[model samples]
Target: MSTSPRLKTQDTKARDAEYQALWQACDRASRKQEYLCSHHEAKRIILESACHGILDKRRGQGKIMCGTSIVSMVHLHLQRDVNSRLLAEARMSRFPSPPPNDMPCLANPVANAGNPVGYNDIPQQQQQPQRVSPMISAAEMALRNEVTSLRQDVSLLRQEHELVVSSLQILTERVAKLEGRQAVLEAYPNQGIEGRNAWMLVKPMSPRSQTQGRDEDMVNKAADF
Candidate 1:
């Protein structure tokens, strides 16, 4: 093996060792999976992997760095789902199963004296042994898993997009408010502090210089807007 490859292998192993605790916690997610980390950390890891020719985005693959510590796009929704399922199971176990209702077969021939027996009157639940759940083939199961994974990814992306849009809207509203205030300043030149008597106490500029200063300030403020 190449010296660089050997070094990279060692580095990957070391990073894996650092995240052993995270993996162990994911084995039994108490609240949620710790797989998703901060963007700053993701960028550092991604850039480093790219430097080492490990970020293979040329071909269609599940992850850019699957075997390494650089799992930027890795969303462990399955782990969290499994944890929730287990928790639900535990909660369900605490309750006793409800007894089968001894409901009278209203459609029974005997109920109406000479009425014909309806299929609904039959005790199908008691007669028929509980049917086992449908078994999924390997291919179908694989497809289902892939679909689930894609759904989780889509959900995560949508959440991020919503947050970005909300932040942008808030920023735009703030800018609009600032622009409205600045418009008032631009509308009335005489109302400005620079032309007031108190302005002389701060900076006693000549009339020409004061006018020029005000013009420059207006230009700068408009440019900012």
Candidate 2:
């Protein structure tokens, strides 16, 4: 799962790099076109100015002149020649054959009906029928269902285990409290027998006299024992 995201990020980076390179190439081409247009315009202006000067000189000599026409023809011929050379260079730079089409139907002879030697006409190997026991299959299905049920049971048992652990913790707290009380009782040897007798004696006494009576009886019992 984690690797999937990393792979996607790598793919995105590769695509971005390709696009950046393509855009740079396009920008370079556009700049070259602008430079060529500017150069052509400057050249045409200079040629026309020179041609006008030559025609003026010829007119001053009082002679019939075709200087402007000759200049125009020369310009047209130069332009055509330049255009032809550019076209030839472009054609040479291009691939001799067009890039192969990647359309699945055209590329895959097996899937294309237009191909006479397609896989459709080939004889396929006959597959033997697999022999299977119905009882064994039923048993496998039952086992799968049992496994699924067991997984659910295991999850429920985990929850129950947590609850049992919590209950055990509460019980342990209560046991600790009882043990502490017992430790306190054992700390005083004199209080041990008296504490037992106080619970054992069924006779009721007034609250004011209870303590005194319990102590006196405890002392008497200790002496007798």
User: Which candidate leads in TM-score?
Assistant: 1
Which tens-of-lDDT digit does each residue in 148-221 have in candidate 1?
Answer: 65676799899999999999999999999999999997665453254555444444335655645568788778
lDDT: worst 10-residue window of model 2: 26-35
What is the alpha-carbon lDDT of model 1 when measured against the actual structure? Answer: 0.51
Considering only N, C-alpha and C atoms within 3 Å, which residue pairs clash in candidate 2? Answer: none
TM for every model, in the order presented, reads 0.32, 0.23
Task: For each candidate in turn, give its C-alpha RMSD to the true structure in angstroms.
Answer: 21.1, 35.7
- For model 1 the TM-score comes to 0.32
